[model samples]
Target: MEENGLLNDWTNEHPLFDNGQGDKLSRKSIAAIVKKYAVKARCVNPAIIPEGISPHSMRHSKAMMLQDTGINLVYIRDFLGHSSVTTTEIYARIGTRQKLEAIEKTALSPEPGSLPIWQRNRGLLEMLENPRDVVFNYYL
Candidate 1:
């Protein structure tokens, strides 16, 4: 850092990361370091990592990875620092693996002839509250 005209006396600077014995660097400096290494890595192996990879993009990938692991949407929302879950939902794409895992985890559907009690009744007075589960009886 000294050779690059950067400060080496971190004792006074409040940095997010420090070597404990070295000068502290601001967030901008940290990001610049990452950007520098990314450019170097890109030149070394152009196909290993994307050319445009950045700290923010790494955060996005982490959020998507959490969503792909079948984590609760609400948890993912908080993890990604979104003000609302709707925003986080934008990153939660249900890939084929998740879909298959969800299907496998669900309670096996009752046998064809052995429908649940509500299905046979079609529209019992008590079932009127929320019949969305009865898909077969609904036109939609």
Candidate 2:
């Protein structure tokens, strides 16, 4: 398609891929193309393409790939034209090993001799001990 100049003239007025008549390809046309290629790929390797693969599945796979490459969810949301980053978070799902690795990577290690702030503050400790007796001011 690139060799045929279909990919060269992309603009706001022109779509990336189009039908022969200079119009955008319909959803059915795009699905048919994907299915055709998937069938051909399956002939070469039956395990490569799964059954019931659709354009939406391809889109999800691309989103997951982008997420796996460390791309931000906000960026992925914009790339996928999603209205909300929360919607894009579906692709941010990680496996158990990935979750553990991420947690370990970000795990906090306190300084050797530094005490926690609550332990160091006598007034805060008193406040914790007797909440009603202590008058907490917003400025403090």
Candidate 3:
């Protein structure tokens, strides 16, 4: 996997993450850090953000982006560690959002209408309707 660049394991020196440390990062602290950095960067250049963007938004955006790339829902569900597929489905809001967008884009989508055999030839229904024609066609 590493050779193919599919997956990489780098838990050894994660700054925010520690081994055997029960202190997980609190959401408030992360939000404050994100806000501080975002504010500082925007002060230098306001184009760094639009407005009201937070770390949680960025994380959700990343998850949605991953789901939009055709990754399996089951895999995403497992990655998020949901107790049930239904629970994992909450994280799949992005996928559903994309699906809704697609439906809107293809609101006037075309259909096959009918199969080739249905249009070109008689089937059991036609045969039952006209037994003589069916027998004559079969003989011919």
Candidate 4:
């Protein structure tokens, strides 16, 4: 399994446990490696990463990135090797990133104390019918 002398051997280096059936890298060892790499990645990108991040979060983030671009859930499920599509659907949430981007792209900034003309008809009727109750009844 040698490829450019990077991995000279693909077999396990040591017995997994006293049972002597599994590979050298146990689940605990893989978990520790994942945690170590996660910490290293956080150190490199503190602004993008949040506290208490784990290895799974990276998978979730990748799925979310694809989801934001309107990628298919089935493709994402297969990419993540999920047994069920439902598991992958959890990563499709339109979180703060998409919300903020949409708002920044489409938000209309009205002048102070002035509604957009699109609402002028409604405002005019409200003003003429009941100006006093307009403040109490109008809800943004």
Per-candidate TM-score against the hidden true structure? 0.49, 0.60, 0.49, 0.48
Ranking by lDDT: 2, 4, 1, 3
Model 2 ranges off by over 4 Å? 1-12, 95-97, 100-140
User: Considering only N, C-alpha and C atoms within 3 Å, which residue pairs clash in candidate 1?
Assistant: 10-23, 10-24
Which is the better candidate, 2 or 4, if ranked by TM-score? Answer: 2
lDDT values of the candidates? 0.65, 0.74, 0.61, 0.66
Superior candidate under TM-score, 3 versus 4: 3
Tens-place lDDT digits, model 4, residues 38-115: 778878887755666665776788998898887888998999999999998897777545644554465476789985
- Least accurate 10 contiguous residues by lDDT in model 2: 95-104
Query: Lowest summed lDDT over 10 consecutive residues: which window, candidate 3?
Result: 11-20
Report the Cα RMSD per candidate: 12.5, 14.7, 18.0, 11.9
* Candidate 2 residue pairs in clash (backbone atoms < 3 Å): none
Query: Compared to the true structure, candidate 1 yields what TM-score?
Result: 0.49
Q: What lDDT tens digits, residue by residue, belong to model 1 across residues 29-105? A: 66788789888887888787776677777877777788877688899988888999999887776654554455446
lDDT tens readout by residue for model 3, 1-140: 45634354663334443223635567787787788888999999999785788876786666567788877778777776666778656665655446445544644544577433322444533654444456543211
Which stretches in model 4 have alpha-carbon errors above 4 Å? 1-27, 40-49, 100-140
Q: Write the residue-wise lDDT of candidate 2 on 5-109 in tens digits.
A: 655645556876789887999999999999999999999999999998999988987887788777888999999999999998886665334544554465454
Q: Is candidate 2 or candidate 3 better by lDDT?
A: 2
